[model samples]
Target: MRWGRTPDSAVTERDDDGYADLRSYAAIGDGRTLALIARDGRVDWLPLPGTDGHPVFAALLDAADGGCVELAPVEPYTVRREYVGPTNVLASTFTTAGGSVRVTDSLNTGISGRLPWTELARRIEGLEGRVELRAAVRPGTCLGQASPWVHETAHGPVLRLADMTMAVRTLGAEDVVPGDRRIDVTYVSSPGSRQLLGLVGTQAEPLVLPPAEELDAGVDRTIARWTAWSEAFSWEGPWSDAVRRSALVLKLLLHAPSGAMVAAATTSLPESLRPREGVGGKTWDYRLAWVRDSAYALTALFRFGLREETHGAISWMLGSIRRHGPEPRVCYTLDGELPRGALEADVPGWRGIGPVVSGNPAGEQLQLGVYGDLFAIVALYVGDGNVLDAETGRMLAAVADLTCDRWQSRDSGMWELPETRHHTTSKLGCWVALTRAVELAEDGHIPGDPSRWRSEAERIRSWVEEHCWSEERGAYVWYPGTDRLDASILLHAISGFDRGERMSRTLDALREELGCGPHLYRYSGMAEEEGVFLPCSYWMVSALQLCGRTREARELMDALQDTPNDVGLLAEMLDPATGALVGNLPQALSHLALVNAAITVATTS
Candidate 1:
């Protein structure tokens, strides 16, 4: 993951055109929001105020018009960065011919927790001779969603865009001069010298510009808070480092105020590194929390002794579902609302891929697997000795009734494709739901007709075993009457389903058709569409281990989970062939899969 050193004075990457390789960026955040900082020292993608907000710094999505905050050396310099211990604070050393400088960046939080408003703090210290650094704050159109402007304010200067007021506080630099939706300054770095840069933003509220000294001090407090949370996590596995990092990534994606976990910190990062017709044009906004993702997060969080996240997720998820009543949307906003649907934004998109999208259509789709997601979380909570309120139990029983009535219908499966079908995984999801419901009923946790639930659960199992199982392919097809295989079926490996020699052979069939290098394409016929889906491949590890192939599972787990980028962060997918990270940065489901896979193998092995 090293940048190329140039023969000339400046050290730069092959992508000197402002766009960076997706793999070269690292994620830094508070629980409220996240920012992607590229190797060249650009804060490329940031959803302002909150994870679900509009991106105020969106250069990652539209390099030309997308806004960004730059805090890099004026000259070319090679850079390397790592998190400061377990904290999301980033420490990067930039070495230029004149000297080397270290930049520590963190989303400042109070000693108690997150701040009332958002503040991005950058602390600059000189480690060597002398160097010149340039700092700029450029607000973009938010992929044609908003217009940004600058104006004078009682607190020095402020930038305004789409209901957000932004102010920059500097400890050392030139005077704050506001340009066309831009602010810039230049400063010198001397040995043992220190400087601070803080960007404070508030949406639909008065921007609170904290003092430079206070912001600088808050970095330490933020680090301490992160350390406390990370230290509180418990893990005894050999892959503790990897698991801990994944947990931290999940925490970063967690919206602390709402107790909802976002899928990713970013949007519109393409699935395909190169724009292929079927692969590249598709870009999704994954900022909202999904029931499936939070359910997965719940398991990992509960396993690692992170009770706050688990409880928050459970409360938010169940409450949101209760609000939806008859059926839950595939996902929800940070504030528990449904998305309006995706629309192609005017921003040219990452590297001119075009049609950068906003909102997720899955929110409106009938992902039948959501029943399993809903029941699985509730069952986990109840199994952990927690009590479900009568209201929630009644709500869940109604959900179970709906699952029984609709499990036979064709609908968008876990993949959330436009084409509806009797996806094997979808039916299995219903089976899981009903089985868990029956358990809950028998345990006196939730109100349910155990007889009916168990009967329907068996019916779902029989239906899948009959129609979904492809005798010709010797594997469970993606849907009934198709040769296609879905990687999500691997979830069945650990879903308490009967896994026997038949399931073992299906695992092999999936590997043969979907495996590329150490990666597995998300489904049949997707090898050329995009990078291998990270979660699907990680799910393979669970499938393998549960199938009694611990050695193979461990080997694959070692290959996948142990090989993240320099910052130990992974995106939604990866071009295993080229080693380019594709899709969004530090995806929650991907990290959750890694954590759960390790937990699965550790407990089994």
Candidate 2:
């Protein structure tokens, strides 16, 4: 997307107050942490040290008291940027009448065994005649609670906040004199002139600050490493470039030590069209992990030839399953611990949406579809000829037994709402899990009572056919009672069950009852809460493709997947009528479904 021109000289002349416009923001983070950098050159939303840490930069909370780091051009310059190559290394080109500058930023890769440090490196090379630049450097501590002391050293001056130390290594700036949690400096660069600025934070232990030259070398090495990683991807598909980028983003979001992938790199961005709600209570600290996304992420990684992430996430999931028993929590922290349930924050929501939340309340909800999701992940691995170990086999059998016992019960289903129902999709999930488990057992991949599993699978299928189907509407209802059409039933269609004339009739009924302008809502607007679920709409494409309607499926897929933001990132929900992004951002499930839908259409066609 195009970016706004740099702020007017006056705005840059002082520490500007207020939040950065949503359109101007970009994200960067280590796998374990993330930072939001706006086009105006402010690092506004970093959770220092780790994803779960309190913000060292809390502009996402109360823009006034929330801290940030500012780096910007001195004069007016329009901005445009993208990740460098396929890596998360961000490059922004700033252009003005006199000259231009391209600034690259990233958190340098962690060494195999090295001290912890957060690095921000800025490189500026003049493009034309000359450009005068002004920079204001500020660092906040503990959610803007304490001011760091700045001291001048021979290498450069250091900014220390309690035990954490940030050493700035550069040649062309004045000393870092403190002012209201801010530091100011100015510099000028002619054509071909360059400058490198580095910020490194270290713990209270005896620290050895690397030399400026070594840090420079480290930046080059980090880029090279990212390049090699991208080059190793084995993806070959119609959306290979997009898939590769998504895979890279997934990689960047993966916490390697723990084998968890975060839903997104940011929190507190808004779902409503209103920008004010984008700030506080609207915030969902996505730094945690969800089991549903973990299974899907594992499959996606495996598809792109990243076996390590696949294996690691599965190992983590299995351990979690063993610990929590047959029923899995909807999500957990990176370390696989249960959440304390969702709570409303006293802080204002993102923008103005009230109740910035910490832990997800979905953790306690019974999303029975999770059974099938876990089964599908393991089934995919086994289908690829991988062996299932005894421990993992027990986990699969337990999941199957749980499905047999609870499949008929009403549940929150995959949506995680408060109202429970004998959701058609939940029963279908049980069918899927049992069906796959039987297949694995029959193939001697897992030790299970195949006859019992087959009987349970048939039982679910029979119940869905008899009860969930609607003779009046000529389709399957959202739940057992309501005639309201639901987009989630598309899951059943894609799962290879009941692909008969009746299923076709249901697809047509869905088109009329629940379909929006071009997309499909999760269900009719009769429900007071919930935005249109975008991923379910995409699931329609997969269903249609699997049902032998390739042309319609491709058309719908094109329309639905085209609704992402400029950078091809989708939110949790999109306005069915307006196609505007609503709900949470860069949703992993949405994108994962997109990739899978594309794959299905491509292969089947």
Candidate 3:
């Protein structure tokens, strides 16, 4: 059914099984973890401390079996909700015939912004007249498995298990509803009074109690802190408001203390439309950090003058690389452990999307572009006059040396597919890594084998020109043996590997093959299995800028940006025919590409 505050032109409908519209879930997190809060005042997805931690609540997977904490008017009422200020603290108003009540939801802030200890507090304030209130505290199915017991304690109700304990408090409400894996209660409040419902985690330890007054102050302090944090951003351009809102959302996704950024706040929101039957496997856990994503994320953070955050990400990446050792892993846990394999959840997936997956399989894949990504980031800082220490310089040289030797070998490429292929884009990535290596060496920022890097990068260039070029199509192919037009070639052009006639020819070829309306797909007429990639369109915009095709780049960017949701959140892909958002929602890579492409266009055009 149509509900909550959505864009004016948006449409909503209940599915056959009476599911709420999936789009109503707004997200809040402490950077290391995330929670999806629905319009009805229920939080569905919250991992306790780390992104890979067992979820405290997981209604995002199976609504009935998955647990949630809900607050609302006991009597029938209309609902309205919005974020309080620029913060993730959400205020939802319940209006009954007698009066109205506004309940605010927030994850408590640590003193002066320490992290890993999470507390979610809800407060209901009566307005105008007496309003009846209702609450249900139910938790089940953590880490894709259901919980064992639902207990009613002397103080309050508790959901206890091996790993999680959520003690909840309700004021002006009685536990009237019986237990059936769901906790329900109702009460009445008069005007000029208030009630609080607090959900705090003990992490299976004895509950530590913070007094009601302190908890309330904590909530207020949190609101103020986020307000102060948001003011640091200064935007002066078209779509500033939208841009600011997006930037704020992104900031909320960062783990404040650790400075590690998550790719998205929700997992398995689905990347396809085929799973209308609710089979439960489409959801992929995105809470963990990806090297590629962090690389791009740091760049965006730096662009906005959030240098501390960028440095934090840099530290995390470097530490993870060191821990993982000589071969850098593609993705890792927030705590820097390499994930084992994909986990299939037992719960029914969101909207019939089968197999809500936990832990990424891509972690095991061999993606060769990471070296290039790392080098590009480090070189950017060095070019800005930041000095690289001797160890960091040695690491950069080692990475470049690896690139020189391995760029010719077939790998998974940027997409991390199952098959290893001679990917043209990946070879170009090698070119970028080596080229930056040469730049750093020449600038005296690092002691690298510049001559070797230049010679090796030229060897890769010669290989691409000889084997990857398509005489029939007059543009570079996706792989050595394939004539398919892949959108990744746009990145090759934008990276300054081939910016002259070769780039112009590839640009025309990509436009002819990959362009769907104003946006460009990752490849031409790919099968359903591969999906339509949106980031490639962003790469196209950057390529256009690098090639002096400013008008096309601006036009394409404007058109592609319209695909994001009302909150200016972008998905992984968009269907060419129906314009439906496909792939994962709120993709960090897509947004990073957008921000960087905008910067490129502004500086160049």
Candidate 4:
């Protein structure tokens, strides 16, 4: 039940300094945590207990002292990788001179979903002539923030990492040797032979080290559940393959317990390959759940008819905001708590970019765009014939009233920079939020003053048309006074604020200024600072279709759809010239944008 084409993935190679490309990694996860496996069979990033905390295999962020578990060929080999079917489970084949072996990797789930303890299983099946392979598991020091040590006992080797204890187990291997920083094993694979390595751990509870064979069976069981879920997915639109793949990637990012989908699995991957002297830090922790991201995630989930995830996400978002707000934080923790700002850890970032961080700086920003993000999802939920409880309705009504008051105030815009200028995108977000709130009140879904909300929305429209639109640039400038451009204005087309002549011209202006063909910088002056922002590129695809340029949208989408790495995963940004992935791995916003763009084009046309 494999998905995608023949897996002739990249020819395996590392950088001169020994690191895999950001695009060369695939992800597998249980409901609670995620693990990244490089195409060359290295488990480089895994956060035990949950997706929000510190990781054992933090090599993706810190190549030095950031531990990794390697299960790769001993001899020279070429490799290819893909998810096992539409599942998060990854299977990589290493073809050496002697033969080949298919290593299937998974973080096993229980019958009822997430296991009480973390279990990582890597099962090897020989496919051709005998091939020799090496395996090593080195627990990290939490990016030099905590101490980790391996203890050899009568039973086996146990890792005491921070407050957690991990038991590493192996079976059907020819040799096993243990060292201080790592545990190493060597195995020979003959045709039709099978072997396994499994790690079981718990943070506070006792370890549940199941038999190695049981771990192998767990991989099969997880695959079966993923297949059932994929078969149930509903997407008949154009580019369904890419849409489906994006959905699967988003599902992996969703924290099942709290229903809070993280922004990305791994953080501290640099957005800019090289930092500029005046540039702000390009590395930040994105493990926090952003309201904007979840807003797009709900839309993507609804388009697929995924009722459980749709409802789960909606509940988590509203519940968190209801508990924590009069005004919402830009993002929240996976467990529904406020986050401390991104605090730098003692590790060099990917490619030696320093200032790797925990937590996220955005949690403190006042991104007025979130009002639009929040109201849009709730409007969709109620429109689908779902009834909101009185508490949520009242809560939302207050939020709408607040939006009317705050619409005129300047705050950080969608990009969440430190700047507090009167950004055009912020004004448009408030406009969309209030506009939807009035509709909800008119429809009896809420108890807000529809007249007041409607007036504010119109006023916002007038203000933006007067101030944000720049006649000199023949487009909506970044704000009122400057000739700068912002790609986020593309969202206005999707929001129905402006899909006419002006927006069409702005789209052209954006392409001419911020875009190199379909590859777009997030805003003016960011061109030399970062890679093409992946989500901004997809937003333009939606803008194109909504602005009556269907042919252009489809053609651009066709070129970009096949650009995801061999495993159908996208990073936050990519070097436009080199096509090298940059920023965080498997970013949820990137995938969400892809899903919504494909769906918008298909449904609108």
Candidate 5:
């Protein structure tokens, strides 16, 4: 299962362009926060203290000022990276002309739950001959607002920027130099030698440094926890490895304190790798949790036999709605508060893409899809023999009532487009909500007027059939007035909205119009404009399976799985032409779709 060259093989060196490809990065997390590690042995994107907190190492956005930590050989080398077994611990092997070294990276976690403070541990082991290692830490503020200063501490040298402080500890290093806004360390190792470098971060609090041995032990403990978690996954289906990896990625995005799952780890990574002049305004902050994304993730987790995460997420969603208001917002912070509105960053974004955003504006949009997402998760929960409390039942009924009143109105739709319209997908989502609510009421799972809910559901079905279907297009249009096609309607087949020939025809239409190879655009006219949406491609896999195209479904599943980076991780989108990863890394929706699609292929084929 090892990758890269053997000890006897002659190795050559390759130079890195300083800017690491998004696909060349792997993620490690402790359920509280996450850090992105490139194959070149650098920690690029980390939101210290909290997953939703401001970034301390955002080199993924602005490499110069957006902080980073590098601990690799000063000379160029080839890298072979992969996770340690099924755990989130990432191991990267560097092969040079002189020797080879293996570096293991992890965001330390405990067996009980997330640890109190954030810590990133890197352990280097020399495989053969002698190797020289260099390490550096450059601290940057949130969106290039301030630079860190070295503050000599009793324990070690601490990097401080405003209220944030981070302590760095090293083992077996020759010298440690503190530079302006950075710390540099150099060391040498012989065969069978090991060294540990650890960084612990805190916000406006006293920095406590743990012993090097203790921090090193934390890496082993974290790996054990991840292995134990992966062992509990009950999936023995197709693409089991991919499914488990996706599950692990999804777990990384979960805020254990609040049981809220964020949409992605990093925000403002552009949707396209093209120049900023061409694709400047499309960047957004996705650190917040969307009701739709969390709902879908919950459903996928349930299918994987993960009860704790499923129930935890459901409880969080219900509690958040109750705490915020009766109506569901498009998105919320990990703690259930509405996002503070969009804030533009001063620094250039990833690859010089400008206007890096901090907060999401979609929270204010009325996306009717939230109703369906909420009810759908509840339906799956209740159907799995779980009981709902009276308070939750009342909340569900109130949501149903709200859906009945708003089903006829215009909305921003699932994609959160600006122009409001009676999006067919929105109407269908309302139909799903009311239909599930009526079933829950009839089954005594929740208190509601089943007859009224059923009436509205039937009305929506009739309205969509009359207005949304385009006879000329031979498939469902994006809306009543537009003849455009949307990839989202492919979910109707899985939702039982229309499992007959019409949905099959819709699947074909989507493939012909939106499909690029196996990947697909979110909607029409997105071909040359944006990267292909990864989740939509997975949706096509499920849609194909439902349409009796089992062989094609499996083929598409294989193609979709192949699209992940070398480490088996998917971003939100992929460059249609170059296949480079675009948008946020470790996208929860993309992983969720992969898990669900694998399940579909297993069950159908």
Candidate 6:
């Protein structure tokens, strides 16, 4: 069942000026970090040591100064690539006029857990006639102003950039030359010939090259681990393959040691390819965990009966709140600490979009919706026959109390925009949190003032019904005084805030106003600002199902699944005009929404 590359016909290179479309890249991770491999046999983006660590390969953002690991045919060739079944291993087949060869790529992992060292394994197998394979490993200082050099070891050559050191090993290659910033090697492979190349990285430590057999075995072990994890998934619903693949992608973004799920594997990947004064300049890092995104991920995993990931996420959130306080920050690092302020890198952004940013300033923003997001995870966990500890119960009660105190104030909404207003979605998010808190207290799972929480929840609900609904728009507006539609309201339909004709009418209004084909913008006037918000599109699918439009829901699911990259990975957003993926890659929100929407379609249909 492994999706091995079998050469069927010749492939053609499709790149616009050497820059691959964002949709043309597939991802491979070892639960610690991830790398984006393009269709043309290039490792474009990789964060070494950790998911939130500095970049070693960042060609996805800056092709010139950013480093990359490339293995491709010297001549123009067609390519076909896919992941090995139920695993993150990628096999890409390159076919030229003379011959075809298949290259297998993986982030090697240990059998028990993540390996201490970062290893990237590329196995090239000759499939047809003779073909020349060119390979190179270039190291960079994560867009920082540091120089890289090459040093020779007894075994082979090593590339070093500042604190990071990479050991390069080659098998079945000839005419290898080690350069200052890159290592170049070449080999000719005919039928039945094979070659293996490995790059292992360690920061501020002496390099230890594992034996050749051990490195080879690492690939098998990593594949076996991923397969075992996938097999254990308890989903037997429609779109099962896609759903399981989404779940696996979500698992890849999880920082296993800390149980924090990152929003994406990358940062500062521009939301648009073209530069438009203010809009094209919008790019932010997503390597940290947002409470809202994590809550959605936990809910999705819980739906598939994945207790381990659910508990891990809950434990991480609770631990963070206990350490920092009951007030929620917009996002936290993988280690549960507040992220430092954003830093503007002096590197050309993706496709020359300037102002490549690291870290995120959104950490300081007052995102009021997070209260509901955090509690929603707790409610789902307890509802699934799990018990909360005494400390967690007290934490929940405190958060609910804070929500009651702050629901009347204005703050940044779910989109995290700067202009603060009375966001109707934020109000309802508190409503959801308080409502769930009351239910938990009533069920004796938590210690809380249920009567007070219920009263506050009802008060918020009444306020929303009174002021947020727009008679002219025939749906709930983003806030009062503006007839703008927001896709975030669709989440309430999933939350059971209102599943009656009112929500159905809102769905129709959102579709008519905010939707472009199967994709949806976050709010009014956003099409010119950014790409289509991907999670909002999936939210519509769930909303349609809630409204009894089962056929429409299934159709939307099929179309939305088609939007992923060739390897079944979704970015945070997509270009409605060109269907190109935009924003940070392998986004957790998009994947989680997809999983939930598929389950909704399955259960409703």
Residue 253 lDDT (model 3): 63
Off by over 4 Å in 2: 1-17, 20-23, 110-115, 136-171, 202-208, 274-283, 526-531, 560-562, 575-580
Candidates 4 and 6: which is better by TM-score? 4
Residue 75 displacement (Å), model 6 = 2.3
Predicted candidate 2 versus true structure: per-residue lDDT over 117-207, tens digit per residue? 6666666666676666665555655543565667766765676665666666554553445454455655566777766666666666544
TM-score of each: 0.96, 0.88, 0.90, 0.97, 0.96, 0.96
**What 10-residue stretch in candidate 3 is worst by lDDT?**
1-10
Which candidate wins on TM-score? 4
Model 1, residue 129: what's the lDDT? 86
Judged by TM-score relative to the true structure, which candidate is superior, 2 or 4? 4
- Steric clash count of candidate 1: 0
lDDT of each: 0.84, 0.68, 0.71, 0.86, 0.85, 0.85
Which pairs, if any, clash in model 5?
A: none
- Better candidate by TM-score, 2 or 6: 6
Candidate 4 root-mean-square deviation in Å: 2.3
Put down candidate 4 lDDT per residue, 331-377, tens digits, no spaces. Answer: 99998899997778887777788678888878888888999999998
Residue-wise C-alpha lDDT for candidate 3, range 371-417, written one tens digit per residue: 77777778766655567778777777787888888887888887777
- lDDT string, candidate 6, 273-362, tens digits: 675885665788999999888888877887777788888888998898788877878799999998888898888778777688888988
Tell me how many clashing residue pairs each candidate has. 0, 21, 14, 0, 0, 2
Worst 10 residues of 5 by lDDT: 1-10
**Better structure of 1 and 2 per TM-score:** 1
Model 1 misplacement above 4 A: 1-11, 14-17, 278-280
